[model samples]
Target: MELIQVSHNEMAALFTRPSHIYNSVGFALLNAPKADSVEFLTFRDTRLRGGLILGMCGAMARSPFSAPFGGLLLTREQTAGAVEDMYLLAAQFAAGRGMALRVTLPPPFIGPGLYAKSVNVLQRLSGGCATVEINYHVDLRGVTDPVELYSRSAREKLRQARSHDCRFERLETTPEAIARVYDVIHRNRLHRGFPHNMALEQIVATSAVVPMDLFMLTVDGTPAAAAQVHRLNHEMAQVVYWGDLPEAQYARPMNLLPLEIYKYYLAHTPVRILDIGHSTDGGIINRGLCDYKESVGCRATPKPTFTVNLRREI
Candidate 1:
């Protein structure tokens, strides 16, 4: 088996279409923006094996991250043994440089066997690394009806929007509209008590990998709300980097935007599932965020976040 470092475009192609989480695309997107330097390692036992595209930093030290790197895409056949290849390759790649291997995987609570093996391999490679995971999935083959898929509250929100003359329009990602979308997401994060780490440069870089569209809910001519639509391998549509303008809050465009996007995917795109991305945990520990998502039509599904201590060294 041989491990090789692929170029940004190659890694982007591998990740932009594969079944792995969108974070992979985010990595390539943020690689140049956040980090002073970047390297993309692609493992190949036969096809693309397993490896990480990490940023260049000093002494493999841990730094606060806005999001995790993407999950490695490995076929069921190549899952085993291939992990060792990745570890050794990454180590060598960071050799002399003394950098830690930090991999962030976003998988469903119930992932394929290869997924579990990945965690086991990462543990074997690193001694210590910060980790976190958010569980969200795409049901590509089932659940396409927006109305049927929506919970009662979600349906009601759409109805309410129509009653209020809230109009929905899907826009293409263009330079002119980029800042507008960013402003909405920026304001939303502020309202939700989170910072906007997804800078414009990263957003533009990331959008270059996969096909992207913008969904907007408008009042008259101004943009009230928007969500970036990432078309994933024709199977799923990822609702990523969303935000609502302050005025949108009063207009309740948050509730309306999702339904419009859902309906658009159902009618125009070949997407079978839509991943709403991050949600607060429900169960004994309930959060308003999770509650809000649930009210709009999300059900609690099993998801996991993992961490590895780099000092441990697999």
Candidate 2:
């Protein structure tokens, strides 16, 4: 029940914990923390109880990921009392420095029961939270036919691609594979007037810290669509980025791609939830994107950022 500034060695060890990629030391290394005071906590005994990453900005203590969702990370064995203790320690630390606390938790789907416990404890301490985004996932358990989850329009698109020479394969997660996938996604974003956030080097560096999977939907043995997936944990794999080549978009690579992505995770890995990622930008839901995800059999969950008033006389 003590709070201390984390060391580099401790940060690296914390990366191995069951947490979001953004909450890891690798991601923290990539982005320079802006808070004048940053709290990198490693709460442990003989066994690690949990970890918390918070950077303080004046009166507000926030997780490093202000835009992306990440924050308090706990182990599967972490009890409610343990979680509360971590928060209480963090709050005391922040209060001493005249600061508040903030954390952007991952969607409930990533860890349903775990998430519920976490939010409940955080709410008890942090007071409440503000919804930042709506995340989506494709549940792959107890499903014989993967295509059954797709919408009618999506099914029609798949039918349209039936005449094309299409094939889906899981590519090795190499530099070349990442570069190729990055190219398709970059172009896809630009063509659609959507903002592109990642660079090739960023993806390469991140893959070194976490498990990454590359998949492609090829037409006539040429890459037409691609998806770069990150294994969030034993139970989930998230598609961080995915897109089809503009020229091959006519072939409906997307329709074929989703089906392949769903099947590949269900068969090749222990992943039961394939996270399609968020369908919102800063809490503003994009209806078209939401529809597309739903059409592909994705379910939604609220991913919010919590705030705890540590300056109070607690």
Candidate 3:
């Protein structure tokens, strides 16, 4: 096995089918503007097997908070030996550059067993000091019928929202539309006292590389709530950014928007999972946030972050 440094285009070409949006080269490109430096690393045997896209903050530290989730994107046929070799090479590279390696592995969207090899490799490398974040996702596979899948409370809220003559619109990905979506998201984050995850420029740039759809819920022809959804792959879709006016909460547009989004995908798309992302901040879980997601028929999954002290390992 050999580890090589490749361009972003090369990495994207090699890992043609990424399981999660966060693991894709497109996501790394979106984050590139904010990063001091970005590097795309590939691990190969006789052929390209796995790769990772990483960003750095100066020479001493790697930027961990840039991407929501990023680590190894590997094929199932790759052996455990290949996994170890890639990880060790990564560790050595980080050590040589005087940087600590930090990466978060997203939950497996393919099969439950797909992440087993990576988890084992991470555990050994991180000295069993992995931190787990609780993530929520709606399983859309068995949801042949929306009535049975959604909770009673959620269903009732959706009905109430519809009775108010709420309309859900799937907007085109135009610059004006993206700007409007970003405005709502920006205000929502400020209201909640949460830091902005990505700038509008970053979001716009990334959306161009990876196709995303913007959905909005309007009441009486007025925009109430919206979300930027990423079609991660054939099997999964994710709600990356969601926002609603404070006044819209009174009308229950939040509940209505996601329900409608799920319904549309359930009927029209082959996607099976709707990832709502983590309800945690800085390793602390928010019960109210988690409860709201549960009320809408979402369940928790474990997403773990792994860190290695390259200085010590070297």
Candidate 4:
């Protein structure tokens, strides 16, 4: 097996159709401003097997805090043996550069076996550590009625939102609209005592490379809640950022925004999963956040991160 570094466009072509939006080339590029540099690594045998987009500062580190997920992307046939080979090569590459290697794999929304293979390989590597966090996703496939997927309480909130004349609109991707969406997200994060992971400028850069849409829920012609969704592939899409005004809590536009977004995808697109993303800080699970997601018919899945000291002799 051989590991090679490729150009941005080459890496973009390989990862653009990934099962997770966070692993896509567009996401990596858009968020590149946060890293000192970004590298596209590919693993091969007799044929193309897997690839990953890595961000580096003093050394390459894969933190969900910086990027939602970053690890090996492999074909179905590439299992334990291939995973082992890839990591070994990755270690060698990192060692050559005198950098430690860390990677976090997204939840097993794509394939269970692949996730297991990756974990097993990481465990075998010297000084390896594996940690996990919970992520939630709403399954939208095979549901004839979108309302049927929500909990009783969520359904009632949707009804209440509609009663208040809450309307959902897909905002045009213009500079003005992007700025408006960013303001809502910024204020929401501040109110929640968290920082924005990607700045407004970074989000705009990402929009240039990825297919993203902004949706807003309005009441009396005023915006109450908004979200930005990124298309991962034919089967998956993710809500990268979502928030509501503090005053809009009474209107419950947050409930209506996702409900309408899910319905829109269900009726018009082939998207099977709507990723709500992980509701955790570091490795700790936030119970209240998880419960709210579950109430909206979202199920929990484990998203794991693995780190290894490449300096250790193996």
- Candidate 2 per-residue lDDT, tens place, 133-191, comes to 78898998998789999999999999988779998888898898889889888988999
List lDDT for all candidates, in order: 0.61, 0.78, 0.78, 0.78
Residues 84-107 of candidate 4: C-alpha lDDT, one tens digit per residue: 888878876776777767878766
| Candidate 3 whole-model C-alpha lDDT, 0 to 1 | 0.78
Candidate 2 at 264: error in angstroms?
A: 1.3
After superposing candidate 3, which stretches have Cα over 4 Å from the reference? 59-65
Clashes of each: 21, 0, 0, 0
Q: What shift in Å separates residue 150 of candidate 3 from its native position after superposition?
A: 2.5
* lDDT at 237, model 1: 64
Q: Report the Cα lDDT for candidate 2.
A: 0.78
What's the TM-score of every candidate structure? 0.76, 0.85, 0.90, 0.90
The ten-residue window of minimal lDDT in model 3 covers 58-67
Model 3 over residues 103-177: C-alpha lDDT tens digits? 777666544554677778878987987788888999987777655667788888877877787988888998889
